[model samples]
Target: MNSTRFTPADAAELYGIHNWSSGYFRVSDKGEVEVTPGPGLNAVLPDIVDEIVARGESLPVILRFPQVLAGRVRQLNEAFRTAMREYDYQGRYQGVFPIKVNQRRMVVETIASAGYEYAHGLEAGSKAELALCLAQNLHPDALLCCNGFKDDGFIKLALWGRSLGKNVVITLEKFSELERVLKVARQLGIRPAIGVRFKLNARGSGQWEESGGDQAKFGLNAGELLQVVERLRQEDMLDALVMLHTHIGSQITDIRRIKVAVREATQVYSDLVDEGAQVKYLNVGGGLGVDYDGSKTTFYASANYTLAEYAADVVYTVQEVCKSNEVRQPTIVSESGRALTAHHAVLVVPVIDVTGPTRGLQSIPEAAEDQHQIVKDLEEILANINTRNYREMYNDAVGDKETLHNLFNLGYLTLRDRARGEALFNAILQKLAKLVAGLAYVPDELEDLPKVLADKYICNFSLFQSLPDNWAIQALFPVTPLDRLDERPTRQGTLVDITCDSDGKIEKFIDLRDVKATLPLHDPGTRPYYLGIFLMGAYQDVLGSAHNLFGKVNEAHVTARPGGKHLVELFVRGQKARRLIESMGYEEDMLRGSIRAQVDRARAAGRLDDTQTVELEEDYGEELLGYTYLEYEE
Candidate 1:
């Protein structure tokens, strides 16, 4: 370690916190990660967690800043508005937050409440989500867009929005859904507003490019779309067509693809106007990307374009196409659910333990004469290794460790010998790690030694329950220590969750240059340490699965008020064992009875007295009602 001073700025650069946090988060002078949710309002993340812990809450809690949520909503809408102003666009911009991004009541309600000022609305991709939207006290003019496949009941519920004076648009996912819509409208004797989702010839760039082109799972082909327009014309229902929509997928990376898609969709929009259909809105459905990696590249985890650039391309491209076609410009609609919600919720997990190949592990001393030949060879490498012979000694130690392992397995050495050999090997690697860092250039084989020797941090949260996207889709979220930015990180490590599954660990982390196989972390020792998984508000909460029956973690909703004040408005405790099992179809009473039967059997077999049986039953009952996660003693 050098004698130079380290600062929070250095830590910020090391973790790329400023690179990906947008503007909502930063490190304070006191080495704490401070979140500024609104003007003149800020809160320290560790301080909030301390408050929760003070109330006897457990590890792995989610802290949501509704003010931060409001900030994102405002930022997105303002981005499009700025684009429109800069591009001199005549079409108005309205953004809708699709509930599928994060169907939690607090999340959706925050967006709806913040967005009502800009006439922003809700988009539902399922019948249940549509019901969720209908229950909100949304702005009267906000577009309540009902997407996805529609049954008769789905269409009827959406049509009922018209009776209640809500601006509901039933978008046709497929040609067949249009028939169901018409049937429901006829039965209700009300002409409902309609939107057609078109399958574009232009494709997007990223993991979900197929969501736009002709191979899309939903949306109508050119011929099918024309047929719908013609049939609507025949039934004098063409005027009900109020919106033209297309989605190029979520998290689109490239700006060129968006420009292409917008141009193509606008051409179709102009053609529909020429055919006498009254379309008031051109909806470019959700694909605004969040730059997860902060690289600003076309990587799977990053976006190559800024939100401002995306808005400009959509507005300019549409204006160019509509003007060329000599048609009136329609109101621009965007359902940018990801961009509006990915930054508000932070999942804070505790580091219960830290491990490595030889972390705090002691080796026994033995005479050289009694040591095995392979172990002696490793001991020699440990003795003579330096910056000069380090390369050769590293190679020799690597070979000797394997041979030592084989000799132990073959009964040529005892457990103590094996332990000594393992310690020597870890020592050799640690020495090589230091030597390789000072070298002008390291060999390719030795370059990865540092990452391989990094520590393993055992976190107290289940990745399957809190950050499922990272497991399922390889989404990279920024991981950083909540406090301790003033000190230098002494080791690198990967995050391992407390799940039983072998795959429940975070190996890949976000980096400005590329993905990191390991994260720089501090040693927690006997004290409590915390790590936060940021930008997890989008889809992660709703998409998580209860693998190992972990269920949901505790959640705290923090509202940042003016004058640097904040309040913990709500704290939602996680699922208990009883609720988890009951949700899995196990009756609570039956489960209790089964345990009681076992206790009775034990009592009858003279394994317990009456007092002991009663105590055991009470303990078992209390455990059943306890939190599903592991409990720690205070």
Candidate 2:
């Protein structure tokens, strides 16, 4: 391999860290990733990892930057404010961070505290989330939006918010929720503020496009909407309607679809105002996309427009529609959860081991004289392989490999010969790969050889526990090495999580032009190597499931103080084996007793000594408190 030199700026541009990180992370001059917690301050990521290790924390920990969260909130609000001022719109812009994006207490609390300037609020989709929001000491005027199907308990909690003088708006997703809201409000002798989620005819563009339009699972139809208005008027509660909400979907890449939905939602708001319902807020619900791949295209993983452009389109469309109808412009509210939180947290995992077909074999061994004929054929193919006839040699190698396997199964070829044949086949493939590396266009038959030659990096993390989105929906997150930015990577590999399941691997990676089949990485020496998966603070945390009994990982909330100082505001340890089993409804004491009984039985049978018994019991007890992940010394 040639010696290639790289700069901090080169690494930044290569991974598009600047595009999505929003100035919070960059490659430093020390050839390590630097965290810009505050303006003109920097902290290296390797140093942070060292600090975390010093505290006895394990690998696969989440590093959160609260300043990045605050910066996003500021960017969203400031963009809308700038757009409203540019368009001369009278209504103000207020946005809420939906708790579903990242329901962790630290994440939600950080957003709430940082968003105080913008009067930023919280959006809850479930009862527990609603109760959480109610418990937070949010700004008095901060809007609390309740969505989804509400039970009696959920509605009462929302009503309780109203009684406490908070700006609580219960958005009716289904028609039945309205009756529950009304009945609960009547029981409490409080008039609750209400919002209606409209099922718009315009469909968004992306993975969640089906979340909107007439066929959506949520929201009321035109006839149902009219019935709601008529019933509210009959009950003398028309004035309670204060917000009109519609969500086209999340991660909307196209700007035109947003403009269309905004226009449609504003028309509904204006018509409701004309009907004397007194709706004061026009809420175009969350669809703000993040540029995950930094391609700025209409791809499923990228956003076609910038946040400022999104705000401008939303502000201009609403203003134009209201002006055309001669109705007063209502206050704009956006529930952009993903955009606010995707950049706040990063999942850092270490590459523990590297495995590949060529991992052990250094050179092809000379074929034994008494070797099987098929093994000899494979060796000949490897020996005769050259640039002119690599394709033919590859075909011969494949045919001989299959035949050797068949012979071994039929008791014809010995295990020794089979191993030699397998090694020779792989070695030939590696040689052919090098020959084809410089080709302008590889042949179709050899196109997949490079992928087969790709190394498998065994990382210390659970795919199902940490990054379920990548496993479930194939979502692409930015992945790059945290250090060694000045040297070029000499190997290509795919990340394999430390799970027993074969599906727990990340094969697709983000590239500037298109999706890459493999990620370039360095050889893992005696020291530990770390890679970070960026922009995972959105739905990954809450949506993750306890697959393979791997629970939540350790989390550290990092605060970049002035004078380039770093502080860990919060540290949450990962789940232990006993806790993980208990979470699955298995009693820890009962399991321990069962294991202890087996050990005592062995001791009684003279299979153990006192020292062995004590050691066994101590090991068992220690295993209970040990981390679920594999622990190692760095």
Candidate 3:
């Protein structure tokens, strides 16, 4: 019989960071989580947390590794290149980072700078994004694809991109958009390149599967696509139809679904080419899924294939379809935004407090003979717990606890008796939990005893503000301690945020089989305990809402040099109290003046002394500039 105690290394295997981190994160010798930009370099996350605290900054900081972003761009492009070479494919892979995934300036500029050599492009889905694309230093030969519903201004800006000597393609989602494209091109007197998003009957699979297929909100029907070609031909603008676009959905886990979509889109492209429409680019829009849970299954959060396998499937499918259609191999472009940026940043928040009996086995007070029968029964259950009778004892304890609650409500039991009953019941649960862990096979009745004994750790960040997907769609992101990987974690806890709402907590955590009810964590006795939420660089920042007025956390851009030296290139402060109030339409000056007036009125009425009045005014100013989060004192 072996009785090996579980350690922090066990936590790593449980969370699957080694499988999903893509060689960028590892456990250090000191048990701290180390973030790597490349070979021969790493950043200690706990040290960064220390530096942040030393600088008087708050918790819940988001650290962006631009090096990681660059590496991902290289990884994606290289995967395609390798696949193309292996298959001896005729067409080149031209990938574009969709701005909608992460529109932050540092993220977009890092992609532009790192992907210039591979001729990677940018995809904008709206006018604002088009303006952003226009300003970026993209490769002269790289593409600038304009998608989504377009107005005249949006169309004009895309045509202006062409005038500025960029390969800009305005993809038409509806038949009416064609007229807008033509009208804007005529007004600007610039030849506009166009693409058509054909609605694919093959639907995707996942949370966003509904965003694709025949009845999707975007994309043109078969009839509409034909009308676009025919109308362009009538106007002698057939040469302007340079690309065909279709997206099954975002975060597509099944590679089979991807191949089906590619084949369908390729057939549509070949049909248009056979009709004499000059389509030179087959834009297979993004569905490259990230393996969030490291399961590598078709589970909505996991991808069934690797980057190389995905590229091979895409390239081979397109090549085979075009070969059978007897059409020339068009260039393949993918807008893989999620897979590109999801690993580049991490959200680090501190566990400020705990709210359960994590200390275990507290001294239970004896119930008096005059107390209710339920309290006496709970005391009896606690006194008689043993291996053979633990199951029956636990059940009896549960029953007695319920009866004690009812007795308290019915005025039959005193508050002291109820309290003692709770403590005894909890203590019994802890003892049973320890015994259950040592058992090779626990009975099915008490299988969940250990989990039921887990604690609730209150972290210093808002779940809605930092991880909206977890709240909105139950998207799982990997979370673990940045330090203490060497020590055994005795506590299993679910994270509760500092928000007032009951829903602002994360109970489900990533697991190999399914989501676990709690996360394994160590006790944060007196030191600051930091938890890093990984793979949140994609849609989280842009989609995060200011729920409960908990604004964005401070952001830091960390750049790693070749010599392993790190630099915090930029630090954007989070929204302060005044800014948040102003964002909701209250004038800052007016609010300040009103506060000053109230203070003066109180002072004149002798409600405040001279020292108190000065302190009050100074405190008001300080509160305005204070971080919206709870500031911890050492």
Clashes of each: 0, 0, 0
User: Over 4 Å off in model 2, which ranges?
Assistant: 1-4, 360-366, 561-565
Per-residue CA lDDT of candidate 2, range 1-634, in tens?
A: 2325667677777777887676778887767887885677766777878799898888889999888888888889999999999999989998898998888888888889988878899999899999899888788878999999888899999989988888999999988888888889989898989999989999899899999888898898878888889989999999998999899899998999999999999998888888888899999999999989888888999999999999999999999999999999989999999998898888999989998875534655656779888877776777788889988888888888888889899999887898888888888888888889998889999988867889999999999999999999999999989998777777889999988999999999988798888888888788789999999999999888778788889989887766446788788888888998898899988988998899989999999998999999899988788888888864
Question: What's the lDDT of the predicted structure labeled candidate 2?
Answer: 0.87
TM-score of each: 0.97, 0.97, 0.96
- Candidate that scores best on TM-score: 1
The lDDT values for all models are 0.88, 0.87, 0.87
Q: Candidate 3 regions off by >4 Å?
A: 1-11, 363-370, 438-445, 561-565
Span of ten consecutive residues with least summed lDDT in model 1: 358-367
What 10-residue stretch in candidate 2 is worst by lDDT? 358-367
Q: Write the per-residue lDDT of candidate 1 for residues 1-634, one digit (tens) a residue.
A: 2447778888888888887888788898878888887668788889889989999988789999898889888888898899889978887998899999999999989888999999899999888999999999888889999999888888999999889988999999889888888888999998989999999988877878878787888899889888998989889999999999999899998888888889999999999999899999999888899898889999878899888788888899999999899999999999999898999999999998877764522543454457777787887888789988887898898888888889888998988788888888888888788778877899888878867887889999899899998888788999999999999988889989999988899999998887898998888877779998999999988988888889889899998666445689999988888888888899989988998999999999999999999999898898788877777997
Give me candidate 2's TM-score against the actual structure.
Answer: 0.97
Model 1 gets an lDDT of: 0.88
TM-score, candidate 1, is 0.97
